[model samples]
Target: MKQRHEVFFKQLEGMRNYLLKVADVTEEEAQIVPKGFKNNIRWNLGHVFVEQYAWIENLTKEEVDFPKHFNEWFGWGTSPDDFTAETPSLEELKPLLKEQIANIKGTYGDRLEEVFEPTQGMDTLEQVLLWTTFHEGMHLQTILDIKKVYECLIEN
Candidate 1:
């Protein structure tokens, strides 16, 4: 079980790195989708980056000192429309994304072996690990979808 946790973190880290690399090629304005429901790649990316801290702190009962207003900006209770489409430049957000992945991989990777109080039907460490990846994977797909729309907008 511990070994599986280790493997999942590795895979999670790889997926996160891939998403960050994709952001490098995305245009800044293209990172904001106005007429659509989704919050563009930047917001989705930032949301996930922020979630590392949120989830870790929730599970580990430790202080993470995450960005202020992150909850308001990215919390599930708050819609993307709650804030303007303003987002940091790729240069800015890129490091944040990388830093977040580093923090999770370095600080919280092994910590997953500890028991997590069940929430939302996740009863074991494996379930929480898998659910986190599932959440991330959904946004990764959102990034790709937003990228396609961004390209179409530019070409048109």
Candidate 2:
């Protein structure tokens, strides 16, 4: 992989690491839907995971491996209210989230510059990956906000 491409991957890994570290909440905490928030930490985490796969698949025009029911449980427009007992817990998602960066790097490291039919204004694999990083970063902030709200509620 080129140095520039590696930078994107590193940025992604760093953000993912920060997210996992910041989300040190218990499963119960992860599920808590703080007032004014439509989703919980668990939903944010799962959405990040599922969205990454969806973006990669769109760019590659091939199926990206992901856990089943991820779209239903965490895809765009999904809500925690829709989650069922079969929905994977935060524990189940952590490892998958950890593994996703490596999977993406290994699968697309050499194909970064490859152009595809434009999706979301991204015509290159590199562009899509960069977008995914930004998307994950946004959700990381949401997760942090959710955690803060719940923690404050507990303290009050």
Tens-digit per-residue lDDT, 9-72, candidate 1: 6787788788777666645553577566557666777677676566666665668866757667
Q: Go through the candidates in order and give the C-alpha RMSD of each one to the true structure.
A: 3.0, 1.0
Candidate with the greatest TM-score versus the true structure: 2
Clash number for each model: 0, 0
Residue by residue across 40-124, what tens digits does model 2's lDDT show? 9999999999998898887778998777578999999999998999999999999999989999889888998988889989998
- In candidate 1, the residue pairs with backbone N, CA or C atoms under 3 Å apart (3 or more residues apart, or in different chains) clash, namely none
Candidate 2 collision pairs: none
- Highest-scoring model, lDDT: 2
**How does candidate 1 fare on TM-score?**
0.78
Q: List the candidates' TM-scores in order.
A: 0.78, 0.96
Residue 94, candidate 2: C-alpha displacement in angstroms: 0.2
* Deviation from native of the Cα of residue 20 in model 1, angstroms: 1.2
